[model samples]
Target: MNGDAVRVLTYNVRRDVASDGEFDWAARRDAVASTLRFHRPDVIGLQEPLAHQYADVRDALPAYEWVGQSRNADDGDGEFCPVGYRRDRFERVDAGTFWLSPTPEEPGSVGWDAAYPRIATWVRLEYRRSGERLLYANTHLDHESARARAEGAELLRERVQEQRENDEALVVGGDLNCLAGDEPHRALAGPDEESPLVDAREASPHPPHGPSTTRTDFEGLLPDRQIDHVFVAGCDVAGYGVAADVMGDGWFPSDHLPVVVDLEL
Candidate 1:
């Protein structure tokens, strides 16, 4: 069998803070929801959504069931890196969250030179129609510290290698906070890394669609500044694109664009 086709979207939903003024989550929540709804991805990996904001997206996409936890240990009310999947398409075989720190098993642990705690959430699913297993992981690395980003990527790669079962297809997606040639990006997708993943954009047969950059900040669409990414292993990338849609008023749904990829696994 060629395996089942899966569509994945990785989005950094930009936290719901009042400082954004007109571009705050309150103003663009529906736009974000609509964007996800319109794309119809089988799985979505989201970063930077606060508890209530995650709730809004969850309520909006009732067809999807989600698994995640706040990155904070205190009251469990902080930014989340959640993984949501279509309930009818796959069965959740397993799921968990791990901090991107030297102490990965400890919740809310800060790693390297990071400005804040970072985490990766993952789920193992069984494609109902084919009984094929796939592992999908989502994360957001540190934005301010390059060292943190690199080490976090390495840690995630290690964890994925350790946990993934033999012959299972793999996918890793997120707003990785680094460009393609950067250390973090290389650590995850570079051939030198042990059991390295393939960047979906590079593996796809078709050219990437939309602007090159993934960060818009609700305004500028800089060229070749792409930071969002989706990487895979044991799959054929059928297509890749940067979802750069905006509202009629020209307001983007989030600061970062979603990276969408199609795969057969």
Candidate 2:
């Protein structure tokens, strides 16, 4: 990559109230911070972070600046799919959040048969040294609604295409809640790798390490459902993998493992 490589990581940190038993936010927050510190991705996107969890990460990783609010509202207390980037390495010139529904501009709106509201947070990052712009879109699809997942995929694809029209490199990360054989995954990736867009894991030059599973329930063992992913366009995938590391006492950083991808833009 000749020093043009950039690392991106996507994680669903598992909200505050939902974490069961020993996996409480207090017990795992530092482990999450340590994971971020160990990998040191240039850009990171997080999903399902409660207000206090967000505050903890923001405080722990002061080197990065972030933008995002709850999917529910601008000033509400709910899950957030926040995106953060290294301030010394890139400048976040612009960013915004939109619901993944028929009325995308309306916050807290639900689409189709979605059980709950879904949202996508996007940002424009200008690489400090290269001066090239990158568009990063982070989202969480409805976990229970097939129709909502499919339709939300189409909506996000349109947004990515709109930004692609400007010729900026694109990276989409999320807890898609759809698997490899699912139609929604196909919709985002088109027919295959021959299509314009490609899944980072599929395009990686180096084989991804660890199990394919990303949802762990914070037990430290990788499960079999690999619903989370990073999709890329206009960039070369240098490497991709599922991070399976854990902190002391068999504690996982989150219920869902973070997916990491290296790109040469």
Model 2: per-residue lDDT, tens digit, 106-151? Answer: 8889889998889999999999998888899999999999999999
For the record, the alpha-carbon RMSD of candidate 2 to the native fold, in angstroms, is 1.8
Collision count for each candidate, in order = 0, 0
Note each model's CA RMSD in angstroms. Answer: 1.6, 1.8
At residue 54, what lDDT does model 2 achieve? 94
Q: Least accurate stretch of 10 residues (summed lDDT) in model 2?
A: 188-197
Q: Pick the candidate with the highest lDDT.
A: 1
- State TM-scores per candidate: 0.97, 0.95
> In model 1, how large is the Cα lDDT of residue 221?
77
Clashes of 2: 0
